[model samples]
Target chain A: MELQEKLKILADSAKYDASCSSSGSNRKSGSGVGNTAIAGICHSFASDGRCISLLKILLTNCCIFDCKYCLNRKSNNIKRAIFTPEEICTLTLNFYRRNYIEGLFLSSGIIKNPDYTMELLIKTIFLLRNKYHFNGYIHAKAIPGASPKLLKKLGLLVDRLSANIELPTENGLKLLAPNKESKNVSQIMEYVKINQSKKYVPAGQSTQMIIGATKETDLQIMSKSANLYNQYHLKRVFYSAYVPINKDNLLPSLEHPPLIRENRLYQADWLLRYYNFKVTDLLDVKNPNFNILIDPKADWALRHLEEFPKEINTCSYNELLKIPGIGVKSARRIISSRRNFTIHLEDLKRMGVVLKRAKYFILCNGKYITNKEFFNKKFIERNVMLEERSLIPTNKEQLRLF
Target chain B: MNNIYIYDGDFISLLNIILYLLKNNLHPENIKTDVYHPSLFENTIYLSILKNEKIIDQIISAFGQYAMRSMYYVFLSKEENKELILYYFFQNALKRRHKIMYYHNLKCVSEVLRISNYVRHETHKMKGFLRFKELEKNILYAEMEPTNNILFLVSCHFVNRLKNEFWVIKDNKRKIISIYDKKQFVIVKEEEFKLSQKESKGEQNIEFLWRIFYKTIGIKERRNERCRMNFMPKKYWKYITEVKEEL
Candidate 1:
């Protein structure tokens, strides 16, 4: 096949792997060439409205394993093509110079077994770094069941590495992608974590969990994601809402991707990462799923009404962050502005706080309250639900899944 | 009297203007910079004796080098009354003992930051969107029309990335060329120099492949033009070759 034809097929197949970030690590060129930006840059957005940061493609679409949820399953009749190392290097360099991408995102479909695919990906990058002297940001996906020595060598060359937790639960992995096992994925993640340093996977490890693939609750998924963070020391746990590309009896056929639920999980994930909230704080046995009507923060605040009416002027930084609309930026602004002058509710808006939800939860001064009835759970929930109606996408289709 | 100081629109000149006004203990309202606009009153006096060495060192030590860079970007802002705003920012910044970076809630401080953030954001976007095509001379050539005069900032990133290659980044709006000849880059105007490009066969093939990849990667089930435009603005769609099909 022509290189262009191969590129089209491989890229189309690789679109299912949705971790497209090219961030975190800053690789220096040392007067050589190509450095990674401290904050990643988005070169373009695909028609799907996803950021095209990396040259995400597959080595080949030919597979030996029959994974029911995948487009490149062995049972599926699809066009397959494998890229030569030289072809990949040429494409990445041209794309980098033209500023088409940050670097390469190379994955495969069990091309001649796991080690062979991993070696091809590593060899392509080694040539890219040593001979071509291309020092751009690279993010490579690890093939499961690959040797530890190969994983170490692979980690040494790339800026960021990922071994996707394709399914949220091990049972989901078994039911859907029977040829694949969750243990192999974790093994690679563990290896990457141990070997990671400035020289190896400097951006650290990140993994993706397919949401709504099998019958997994938001609680189960989040608990799995939180455990991955604590155990693997992950940089990010990307949540990909399962896009029903296959019509198998095993997979749940959906007309639209579960966008609303996916969005709620991300909000809960953010609170887990930044808001210093434990998994238990966000989700309980009674509330197994996030409240789609209101945000996780607002939901938490409404349940714990004693924590409401946090004084904006004298509240601690962490205390202010607990409020629904007050983010890290606005929280810091409140802290600095309070030191100089008496901050009123009017000043809080200018400081970048979203007052729609925060007004119900905070007190600007000791005396002035936004609404006395804000203390009522029913009233607060009604207002938040109204706000969420405006927050929904203009059209029902979501721009991003992760 | 409104004492207007007419100096070159450089960072050092802004510092000189600030220091001159400070030494005279003049209020910020009385001091006006001639760089932006001229006042239509006879009471305005222009002072131009700006070859001072001691003032630069003193200002550097007092404001710190980082704050001086902030002033430079604030000066580049197209916002009206930037001089008066920056004047207030500097006065407040100095009074706070160089804790200006943290004064996010201050109106003047945030105003300076808002402009700098624009400069920073534009530079960051161009870093990823900059496309270099190899011509007949084997020189990598690219063109853009940025909202801000950010050629110096954007080229600094490219110099480190493509140090060994000969390349030129042309700012079509500002009509300036930042040309890098393998080692270092020099900014030249249209009067000084110009480079003509001839499309290479190899370049077309590579772009054809890239366009193919760009088209194939998009999942048709999720097409949100508004979200795409939010990140890769439509204004940039014309220059990005892969996005021309989108046009």
Candidate 2:
């Protein structure tokens, strides 16, 4: 096949993998041709609002394993094209020079075997860095069943690496991706983490978990993510909402992805990492999923109302951040403004804090500003629900499911 | 009454005029003109004075002594509030001392520096955000008329990123234009300029691609209308390749 034809086929096949980000590294060009910008280069945003920087493509679409949900799975008959190491290197350089892409995001199916495919992938990156001197960002996928030594060596060259935990739970993996094991995936992640700490992967590691594919609750998924963050020091844990492309009995037959669920999970994940909220804080066994109506932080604050009315004047930075509507910037502003003078309720309004949600949780000068008569739980819940309904346009299709 | 001073719309010529007016210990009521106006004019000075390169050099030197070479560009760009600059130049010329220009706490000097920084940062960020679409004859056209003198700064980013590509960045508000050759750049006053017929094809394709990409990427379930609107404002949609098609 022609090289352009191969590129089109490979890039199209690889587009479904929602892990195209050129961020998290601070690598600068040292008498080199290309430099990596710290803020990240978002070349384009795909139809799904995901940032596309790299020319994301698979080495080949041919796969040995018949992962039921994947378009490129073994059972699914599709045209496959594989780029040799030299072809891949030349394409990257040409694309980089033309300013079409920032780097290369190369992934592949287990073509022939995992080790053989990984070796080819590693050779392409090696040639790009050493022979071509392409110092721009390169994010290569860690083939799950590849050897530890190959994974370690590849980590040294690439900016970021990801071993996709395609499904949430072991059962999901068994039912959908029968050949893949949850344990093996986690072990690869662990190996990547160990190598990253030893300075092999300077950009750190990230993983993706497909949500709503199986019956796994948000709590279970978040627990796994929390553990991954704590254990491997993963840079990020991306959640992809499963869009059923293949007709499979094992997978849920959905017309569209559970986007709200995906969004809620991101919100919940944000609360965990930045807001200092725990997984348990977001959901318990009874409430294993996020409340779609209110944001995770607001939902938590509403449930734990006794923690409200903390004095903004004297509240520590950490304590101020715990408030639902207040973020790091507002928390810092509250701290800075208070140093100059006693902060009043009106002052907070001017500084751009959400008074409606904040008023329920904070005190301006030893006094709460929430409507005293309408300060009951039912009243607050009704108002919060009203606000949520106004915010989310009530996509009738999504609303129909409930 | 604050009178308006008009120049020939040449930046270097205006700098010389501002210096001459300041050296002669004359303060205009207000500098006003659709023509090129430099900073450091408190009062209006009409373009009655002949263009003098000698006077311009003296002013450039005055700015240079304080390592404020870029300040004159800001001045030429018509960044506001130059009354203190007028006072500083007048004071320094009278005393025959260059130290006054370097003197700290001069409100005009500080304001110019602050605005310069603001303009520079905004221009850099806009470089990343300014979406350019291909036109018919391979002309990359992007329209951004920012509130500040960010045109020159943004051009540098485009020039560096798109080295071999020929592109035009037009400021729709000022009608100022920056055209890039392979290596050189020229800023021209375009009273009325339209995208070439050849360039229109690239624009259409880019618009189509951007719209399709933007629609596909955003997860409907996680749509934060407020956040989305806040980051990508409707006002900017006219310049955005993707959002324009949807509109």
Best by DockQ: 1
lDDT by residue (tens digit), candidate 1, B1-247: 5555555656666666776676687765444455446557625556675566575566558767766677767666556666777778877876875567556667887778778777778888888787888887678888998888888988898888777788888988878999898779999895677667787668998888888988888888667677788888878777898896668
Residue-wise C-alpha lDDT for candidate 2, range B119-151, written one tens digit per residue: 665554465457665665666667875777678
DockQ of the candidate models in sequence: 0.65, 0.13
TM-score of each: 0.94, 0.75
User: Candidate 1: TM of chain A?
Assistant: 0.95
Question: Cα lDDT of all candidates, in order?
Answer: 0.81, 0.71
User: Best candidate per TM-score, number?
Assistant: 1
For residue A202, model 2's alpha carbon misses the true position, in angstroms, by: 2.2
How well is each residue in A200-282 modelled by candidate 2, as lDDT tens digits? 77677888888887899999999988988998888888998887778878888776677778888988888878888889888
Which regions of candidate 2 deviate over 4 angstroms?
A2-5, A30-32, A85-100, A197-199, B1-125, B129-148, B152-247
Task: Look at candidate 1 and tell me the lDDT of residue A345.
Answer: 62
- Residue-level lDDT tens digits of model 1 in A1-402: 888888988999999787888888888886545788778888888887889999999988898889888899999988878888899888988888777888888888897789988898889989998888888888898999999989999999999999988888888888988889889999998988888898989999898988887898888988998999999999999887788998888888777777678888889889989888888998878888887667888999999987777888888998988999999888887887788778876667767788876888887777546558457888888889878877766444434421
Question: RMSD, model 1, all Cα superposed?
Answer: 2.8
